[model samples]
Target: MSQNSGTEILRYTAFSADPAGGNPAGVVLDASGLDAAAMLAVAAELGYSESAFLTGRNEPGHDGPPAVREYTIRYFSPKAEVPFCGHATVAAALALAERDGPGDLVFRTSAGPVPVTVAREGGELRATLTSVAPEVMDIAPDDLAEALAALDWPAGDLDPALPPRIAYAGARHLVVAAATRERLADLDYDFARLEALMHRLDLTTLQLVWRSSSTVFHVRDPFPVGGVVEDPATGAAAAAFGAYARALGLVPDTATLTLHQGEDLGRPGTLTVELRSDDVRVRVSGTGTRIEG
Candidate 1:
């Protein structure tokens, strides 16, 4: 642990290098002494969508980047803890790059081990996280109805191409594509009702989306479970959605997808998702900027 035992909370915005573009994440570079309660308190105080805590460091893996680069990371929402978080992961990576000079960083999370790489690409400090093995499941009709009611969205508004399904890369998210961009932009829902449905289904967030093209999409994530109304740019959900697209054969085996988010909230951010031909792991990339005090 660093000599300064007091928790050091570093603010970072993920998905976009610009501080105002991506989702802001509070990062505690060294969380050696803080307990669970303390971490949660810090997260709540910061009031960002989520915050990341790096508990410690470790030796790098065989296929991993460095010889001695390992970190145990935890994420907290305003209300509670989550199994995993994408934007926080990206934010943490950029923060690490600022200190250790950007290479490969491995994070040991409750969900699993996630590998991240940060490098300068075209004057942009891009960070990519390889998600845990992905999985997808069908949404039951009854559950879909309940979810639709919660969102106050009629069943007819859903896109026929992308049916309601639950996708998981690092965390589980409900994937629901809208028929039109206009429908996607209008995002008002019963927060309480959605929260109840999410709790019942063990969903981390609702991946509300609209496909702009074969490789581009617009997304919004409702994170009631984490006690947030919406996430500007969610890495976890993007990773999961990438898997969903691949499983449905919507995109080629190896393809890159762009997600435009937070526009409706006026905090527009972009996330790039890549699906490899040989691997089930989805790679989500974004730029993060340090949050100045």
Candidate 2:
């Protein structure tokens, strides 16, 4: 425990070194005393897409920061709790790294245990989080149609290569790709309609993307389920997309994909997704920096 379980929330942006870029995530280093309601209230107060709370170290009787290695982590959106959150995980790990120095740590999330490795590259600290075993499934016809209707995107605008699917890494995301970059850039959507569909589907976000190249993609995330219009940079969605791509054989099993996001929102950030043939889990890496008051 770092603080008195008081209001010591640290803000950080993940996936981008610049505080003004990436997705801003509020991190409560120690929330041993905060209940679910309190954590939700804190997340709502922060008004970020998602926030992370470190409930406690996994090991019992571990005193001080020196003895702690693994942690019990929880994630919450402004509206509700999520099983996992990648950007927030990155932010929380970076916050710990700044104090304890870069190293390996495990976060016990609702989905599964996520192993994170942090290292300093040059002057900045970067972290890579390995997601839980991923699953990809074909989207329901009705659901696919409803999603397209909510976005006001024509069926013809979808890229045939990518197809439509629901992918799960730490959280579930609906993966859809636009045939053209222009189609992806225009993102005004029916929030209520999309929110309803997402709720029914039990999805966290819609992974909207356009393929810039075989290994590079421009992406966006519609997070109406999280009570947010869009996520600036979504590491969770990136991880899910990695699984989707690999499962569909859109990319080689062993490949590194670059995701460029938040550009249209003016909070430009980059995320790297690495896929390995031997492992069903995906690894997402990015830089994070503290947002000082």
Candidate 3:
């Protein structure tokens, strides 16, 4: 725990090695003294999609390396605290790996306990987080219609194979698939209207997707509920989308999917989603790099 008034706030971009090619996240390695207001202030000042704060870590009970290092983590967006955030989690894991050698880590988040594993891959540090049990639920017809209207997308524009639904891994997201890549790229929507609709649905972001192949996808996230127009890379949405795909029988029970996001924003990043045949949890993996000022 760091009690100093000037706690170091590290900036790291997740899912990409290049600083300008991924979603940037503010990571506070130690945030013991900062209260909720202070955390919110720091996130608001940074104005990123989300920031991660490491409140404290438990002592190593056993001998070598301990089984897993448990830590308390909190995620805050610019406007409010979120239940879980994927990009910030990756950033925080890489930051920890820099100090302590990579292995297994458990983060006690507001939503639940999330397990992350960090390892060096091809000279770059990569982190994989196992999401909590995922679930897919049906969306009300009226709500879906309202959301489509807000995005100015007609019902016919949606993919008949992929139906609209609400999916949750750590956070809630409305999964809507676009019929074509062009439709997904052109994202000019009423911010206020979409924000209101998302708030009413208790959604974190609208996961807009276009399937390029059976296992390859392009995704965009409209995050007006978080005070952002769009998120360059959204890990939570990716996890939910994985659950959505599995629920819809779009992919086999055990499969790995690739999600390409942030390309339209010129900050391209790749997120790998893996689904296991025995586990209901989703695994999201990506590489992260520190952004030096």
Candidate 4:
């Protein structure tokens, strides 16, 4: 138990094998008595992209028995509570795997039920989470213009192959593709303006992507609504991007995509996004490691 909170707050980085190479997240394996305020406080104090809290097990509407590894999970950002967060989910699942052994776990989130599978591969444990059924919608022209303006990116720099869209897999993200890798590398923007636009559009992050190949691409997330300038490796956004790619015919229905992220931030991480022909939900897999303080 932590001295201040009286609960063990584990720190881990998701989507990378190296502790300092991924998006760091705070994980509280057991947070039964904490209220929303306490959870928010914990998240704010950690100052990570997000933090996950396991509320409890054997909820009223879960699928498995009381003894099963099923629990209600909640995610909180530094500034507010979010419906879902991918990196934090991976961090929490890996933390649980360290204690309870890895297999299958279901997290009932505010958005919906998310199932995660953890397996030991060689010396490291990797986890894959199946996102909720994804949906992709077109962004309005005026809204697109506003987003581009806030980003200070010219419309001509937008990729013609991947149209602008608002994608949702648990949380909403605006998908904007850069025509070139150079355009993706330059990330300076009006933080306040973008934050205002994201708030009005109810966007969690802007999934800025650039295609390197059919299966390989680079991604960056501007998470203004979460009170962060950027998210190094975002799981929810990656899941949403998979759906967007499939919906826009950018990739085949059943294909695997490798997403390279956080490189520019000097915290490189890789995320694998798999789309199955039989399932509408996307799967995001990555390696997580403990970040010792």
Model 2 TM: 0.96
Q: What is the lDDT of residue 112 in candidate 1?
A: 98
lDDT of 1 by residue, 151-255 (tens): 889989999999889999988999999999988988898999999999999999999999999899999999988888999999999999999999999999999
lDDT of 3 by residue, 1-293 (tens): 22225978999999998999989999998899899999998888889999999999887666655689888999999999999999999999999999888999999998899999999998999999999999999999999999999999988888989999999999999999999998998899999999999889899999999999999999999999888999999999999999999988999999999999999999999999999989999999999999887
Backbone clashes per model, in order? 0, 0, 0, 0
Clashing pairs in 2: none
Error of 1 at 69 (Å): 0.8
Candidate 2 lDDT over 71-145, as tens digits, reads: 999999999999999999999999999888889999999999999999999999999999999999998899999
Model 1 clashing-pair count: 0
Q: What is the clash tally of candidate 3?
A: 0
User: After superposing candidate 3, which stretches have Cα over 4 Å from the reference?
Assistant: 1-5, 62-65
For all candidates in order, the CA lDDT equals 0.90, 0.94, 0.93, 0.94
lDDT accuracy of residue 276 in candidate 1: 91
Per-residue lDDT, model 2, residue 280, is 90
What's model 1's overall lDDT?
Answer: 0.90
